[model samples]
Target: MSRNGQRGQAAVPPAEFRSYYGRAVLKTPVWEWKIPAYLFTGGLSAGSAMLAAGADLTGRPDLRRTGRLAALGSLVVSTVLLIADLGRPERFHHMLRVAKPSSPMSVGTWILVAYGPGAGVGGLAELVPSGLRRALPGRLLGRMARPAGLAAAAVAPGVASYTAVLLSQTAVPAWHEAHPCLPFVFTGSAAASGGGLGMALTPVAQAGPARRLAVVGALLETAASRMLGRRTGASAEAYSTGRAGRLKSWAEALTAGGAAGTVLARRSRTAAVASGLALLAGSALQRFAVFEAGVASTKDPKYVVVPQRERVDAGIPVRGDDRAPAGGTG
Candidate 1:
């Protein structure tokens, strides 16, 4: 009823309403540049941990040091990047104050705290040669070190995959909509980054597995990128038309070159090292480009509203509540 004793028109149809640019149809991005650093470091740590475990199981002590140190170093770097991103680094401990399955940050915080110590212990174990540790009174170091490395190893791959879930679960335009590619892209990035670190540190005489892993990771990244480029509308735009496109192209070149270089690893270590470095550099650029494209997409109201409006008109209701009047009366 109207205040004047007449019935009021039904509320204006929501579809009739429109917003200017950057009004934020989607939620704000809680992440920042440090998020990519976190991604990069986490990937490296997990991949290195896996290699360490493999070396241990295969009875290769020389390879063990490479893996352990890589894992521990990456963990340290990742933790630092994460804290740097926080508004209050001292309050980072507040994240561990609870367990929130629905919150990616909470889950990731717990994973990092656990993985950091686990990998650190594994790496420190490398300082003691097995034979020397065995000569001790209780054979104590050997007994404790081996088991700790094994446990960290068991958790490493999960650490690699969880970041994928973390990003995909977010409302970021490019990330959430591209869940399938997120995991594969992240996994490949991790492997490539780890391979780079290994090649940089490990002796040429024993970098065969690192080379192989690099090749595999590069191939996966290239393939996933193609799919990402094919995504329709807004998501596709991120991968094909701007700085992201340039970065993706560079990533492709680096990935291909690195993977191909692996074939010469046994005979040409220099080539292998160069290729690994290229892959790592490419991965960093790719992460930066994705971050930029996501922000661009969300900042433009057209990108946010157009496709979503199409969906709503088609009865799909894909985006936020339309502010237009209802029942086609507007």
Candidate 2:
């Protein structure tokens, strides 16, 4: 019963919520546009490397060539964006000094280190002049191509999914709440983007696998996206409101349209290219949407407070970890 003798009142969320000195309860992440862009490019690079290996093994030379070059290009962009965001290239190098399995960031650094050389060699091997392949050095490089590309492909899953893990393990409520599906969403987006590139770059006749990949990726992405929207948490509001909501709406439309186009494309090069472009746009938007949502959750104190209050009302234990993350002391 209410103090005024009313009963069964519905809880209404406050119009405004603020923390000490009007500052966010959690520090808004220092990350900016570059971080989200890096996430997309990293996923693209991983997907392309995996596609390249599959294409090469299947004897689809054109698809293999496109996938290899795309992977390398995406990797290069991913590295540059990461470096730019850090404001110091040496920070990345410094992080390489120690390997910690418990830290997603640390594991990601090692994964990149292992995957980079192989992707580099695989892509560069294609650039050798036809006449040079007869030379000893060129022949040696050529011989190294298959193994290098396959090795990179083997490591690509970690590259595609680590960003999701990194974001979720942070203090951000929106990211942490949706951890179960983030990896699936990211990997699916990566595959979709790679398949898009393959379709646009390769001839339609050789693009069968790309088409299949595009459809599968689209389905996985869509399903995981639904799970995110349906998950129980106040933080889920972050994804469905404001700028994030607009971007997510667009992402879903483009992904679905692209998949539909791919399925009906058949031998039409024009349709393949158009659909590929759409998928790429959708994948980029998806990253931005997730990034914006996490940032939004931190900015609004309700995301944290309401959840704890609800848990208390329901007689559920509120979870917490008082331990601060350990430094390089390890």
Candidate 3:
């Protein structure tokens, strides 16, 4: 028997090269700009909800109010973007038909359902008059606000992270391979965006936590992105080349610069505003870069073919037809 276990044949060398009519092995993502926009808005909303819950619990009513309002507004816009991405916006209701733990989309839909009303109630709580708040339903809503906001906060991390999983679950080489790190990267982005909003909208005195959060988030995002790029190896070439690379490069620069600005400009409201805007822009650009990278990965057949061929060469059985042809006597 030969080394490859083929009867009466010498071990065949791997094929030098191959191509399938220069076509893509997988379909590119059909999602539009709405998807990336939804990712940014949803993450920002979730992160803001978490911050609101923290501020409320700590008796920082001003920060709490700012966080709540930000959460509510971002959540509304996020939901609209999500629905717009659907094939038929009206059919979005179908996503709630079952609680499928195996389906990220279903789980995410339910999370949004729970979070939307919770954030809305929390945002509106302080708006009601004292006299009206003492009334029947008003009193009930007032009482529910804290608990609802807390509950939403508890689920907020999942909201921010699930989108990462949603992308990672796909067959896209760049996405599936980076599943372990994508959630962390996205969570960091969410935090930075939420912090940016807080800093931009709140007074300097109340912006302490926002500044701290911005610094921590920026650090986390930068570290995770660098780690992901290093770990993905050749699969990440799509991310490093072409349009995705340009977007990601700008994102990294802006995130780092904004974080530095936030720390240095703590006392300067004008400088802080500029930094906050940069962070927000950076967060959005990161999402767009990831989206574009996944699409690009699918376009190139080598990304799909090479990894599987490597597995086959190593004596591991791949589930699909990924084996490369043997090179004869060359």
Candidate 4:
């Protein structure tokens, strides 16, 4: 009997409406902390590599060395995180076996394979003494440094942006809906993180470019995140309502405060350090927030059903996998 008013009506209506007892529409991702950690470290590495190439071209040896070391260290850490996330470290090697143009993960694996060696060679060149360059091998390595750095720099943007695309490729409502702006948000956060590292590690006199980059990155990240929220519609609620909301709020606050502090602390080393730490923390939190939001979106049946329902009502063809059961509501 229908609970609302009918005394003896059957539960099933004349029109068939079937669902899996409100089960989730998609499988929940099993990715854990390592993935977001990889995103942060990878972005930092890529941004630093790009900075290193620019510094080398501009004759800023100090900045170039800092950038190189940063890139190398972060890239190594990022690779470790990625391998850890694969559950079995050996699985990481399997990723190198194929190149799928349509698969962001496959493409990103190749990009990392290419970027890692270039960045490593460039970093090693910086560490080798000039006197050592008198040796044939050393001289060859030195000569290869600039070109390697340039090559790594060329692929750096892809490293920073591809993770966002990977997330967007998923069926999770929050992630897929924010595709247009996720790359921009992540790229900007990467720039901010790289700049923050530079400001923290380099002397104030040589940190001007880093400061500028941080400011620009902060602005872009903030703006793109806002745009993403707007574009996500109902999915945005997943980001705004729970643990995800708290993390994102913290990310925004820290990013804004850090940018302001960077500007105001032009001469104060202590303030600069504080601001730089804030920016780095903020960037990491943003990645975690995005991950959590996607998870949240997947848990709620409405997030899956509502959109599919709207499409049906509008006479739009739903994907075969997403189609509701015959005459079903969802």
User: What is the clash count for each candidate, in the order shown?
Assistant: 9, 0, 0, 0
Question: Across residues 195-266, which tens digit of lDDT does each residue of candidate 3 receive?
Answer: 888877777777778878888888988898877788775577887888889999999999998898986557
Q: Which stretches of candidate 1 lie over 4 Å from their true place?
A: 1-18, 21-32, 128-141, 318-330
Evaluated at residue 16, the lDDT of candidate 4 is 33
Whichever of 1 and 3 has more TM-score, that candidate is: 3
The C-alpha TM-scores of every prediction are: 0.82, 0.91, 0.89, 0.88
What's every prediction's RMSD, in angstroms? 8.2, 4.0, 6.6, 5.9
Q: On residues 1-330, what C-alpha lDDT tens digit does candidate 2 reach at each position?
A: 888887966688654545677666777777779888999999999988999999999999999999999999999999999998888899999999999998888898999999999999999988889999999978988899999999999999999999888888777778888899999999999999999889888999888888888888888988898788888388878998999999999999999999999966677899999999999999999999999998898888888777777778899997774422211111
Q: Which of the numbered candidates is closest to the native, going by highest TM-score?
A: 2
Give one digit per residue, the lDDT tens place, for model 4 in 87-204: 6887778878889897777887898888988899898987888789889889988899999999999999999999888788777788887899999999999988888877777777
The best-first sequence of candidates by lDDT reads 2, 4, 3, 1
- Which structure is stronger by lDDT: 1 or 2? 2
lDDT of 1: 0.70
| Clashing residue pairs for model 2 | none
Candidate lDDT scores, in order, read 0.70, 0.87, 0.82, 0.83
Show the lowest summed lDDT stretch of 10 residues, model 2.
321-330
